[model samples]
Target: METNTTSFFCLLLLISATVTAFLDIDELRNIKYGIDILNKPVLLSTQGIDKQLSETIDVTSKHGQIYRCIIPSQMEAEKQKEEEEKIAMEAGVPELLKPMESGPCLFKTRDWWSYEFCYGKHVRQFHMEDGRIVGNVIMLGYYESEFDWKNETNMEIKSRNKNRLNRYHSQQYINGSKCDLTGKARRTEVRFLCEEGTGDYIARLDEPETCTYVMTIHTTKICHHPYLKLPSQQKPVSITCNPAVTDQVYQDYLKE
Candidate 1:
C-alpha cells in the first residue's frame, strides 16, 4: 500500500466527514458490502472480498497531498506509509466481505473499450446540487475510455504503448451517500479515479527515484435524474419472445 497516499486520503476523508456533519443531511446512506457499482445503486458494502483491487499506488519514495504532488522526505515517507496502511486497512473495510465475481463484471470491462485516456492531470472539487456551495469532496480521480461507449458505437481502441491502458486501477469513490438529485434527495455517490498509462513504468519516469503523474477524477450529473432512486435491476422480461432471441427452440415454441 502507498502509505503517503493513505495519509493523503485520510486527510481528505477527515475533511469530508467534518463537512458532512456540518451540512448534516437527514441521514447518510450507509454503503455496505462489496457491490455491483454500475448495475446497482450505491447502497452499502461489507468488508472487501478475499482478494480485491489494491488501493495503493507507489506514488514514489515520497508521497504528497492529493491536490498536489510533492515528494516527502525518506524518513517522513516511511512514517507516512505505516500510518497510511493502518488507515487504508481500516477504511478499506469492504461493506461486504465475499468472493468477487468470476467473470469481468460491474467494475470490470474489456480492454478494447478500456484504453489510455487523458492521464496525469485531473480535477478535484465537487459541487453540491446547489452550485453556490461546494461539497466536501476535496479531490476526485477522473478517467474515461470508450469501454462504455463501445456499446453505443462500433469502434475500437488502439494503444501503441501499454502505459495508455486502463488495466490495474479501478475508479472508486464515496459519492454523497445519498443525494437529492430527484425532487426528493436521492442517495448519491462521488466516484474517484486514478490515471494509469499503458507505457512502460520506467519510460514514464524522468528520474528513477522520483514518481511521475497522479490522476484525479471529476464528475457531475449532466441532467437531473429527478428523485428516482437508482433501480437495482430492471423488471424481468421475456427474453424468449424478445424476437432477437430467435433460437430454434424459441422459434419452435413461438410456433406452438
Candidate 2:
C-alpha cells in the first residue's frame, strides 16, 4: 500500500532498480523524484490542487568554496534564516554555535522521498555543524555468499543420486533427476550497514554500485558534513568512508 498522495515530490529517487533524486539547492536540500510517484497513475488526475511534503536539511560547503544557497523549509522559506540568527546570537558569538563549513540553509519541497524502498530513505541526518557533518548514516543492502564458494575446488561426486535432471532420459520423461550440484547450493548472505564518510567526495557518486544507497553521506574533514575537494593535478576529489558499522556482517558464501 502507498502512503504519499501528492502528485509532486521534492525528494530524490531513481527509476528502475536504481534510485535518483535532485538537490534543490545543496546536497543537504534536495528535491527527490521517486518511482512510486511516477508509477502511480492515479494521482495524475488531480485538477488544480497543490500538494506538498517538506523537510529541513542542513547544508555544508567549503570555507572558501562557492556553492548555491538553499531554502531550509519548503513551507516557510525564511524561518531557517531567522532561526539561525537567533541561534547565532544566543551562543554569544561563539564559533561552536555558529561553526559552519557553509552557510546554514533550509530545504523545501513539494515532494519527499517517503518511499522507504529508495536509497534516499536512509537519509538519517543531514546537517553542517562546525564545517563538518556529524552522525550522518547512509545504508545499503547487497548480496554475498553464505558459503565460501571462492574456496571450493570442483564437482563433488557425492553419495546422493548421480543423475543430472536437465538431460532427457530414454523417453525424455526425465528420470528421477540426480546429479552433483557441484557449484550449487551456495550459502549466501545479505548485509546492511551504515557508512559514515568524512572525506571530501563520494566515490562512484553516480552509480555507487558498492553500496545500495545513492545519496552521499559526508562528514567534515574533521567531523561535520562531508567534505570534497576539487580535482588536483591528476585525480579528482575523493571522499573516504569511515565504517560507522563493520562486522562479520554475514559470510558471502560458506560450505554447509
TM-score of each: 0.15, 0.17
lDDT of 2 by residue, 1-256 (tens): 1223122222212111211113344422233322211111111112222223332112112232211112223444335545654553343311321232253322212122121111111122234446454453222221221222123343532111133221110000111112234322211111111123433332222223322233232323222111111111221111111111112211212211
CA shift of 186, model 1, Å: 22
> Ten consecutive residues with minimal summed lDDT in candidate 1?
220-229
Each candidate structure's count of clashing pairs: 45, 44
Please list the C-alpha lDDT of all candidates, in the order they appear: 0.24, 0.24
Q: Tens-digit lDDT track for model 1 on 1-256?
A: 1223344445435545322112112211211111111111111122121212112111111232121111211334336545744553343312111112121212111221221222222223334443243445433233232122123232232231133322222222222123333322111122222222321211110112111123222211110111111222222111010111224544565566
lDDT, residue 205, candidate 1: 8
Cα error, residue 224 of model 1, in Å, equals: 32
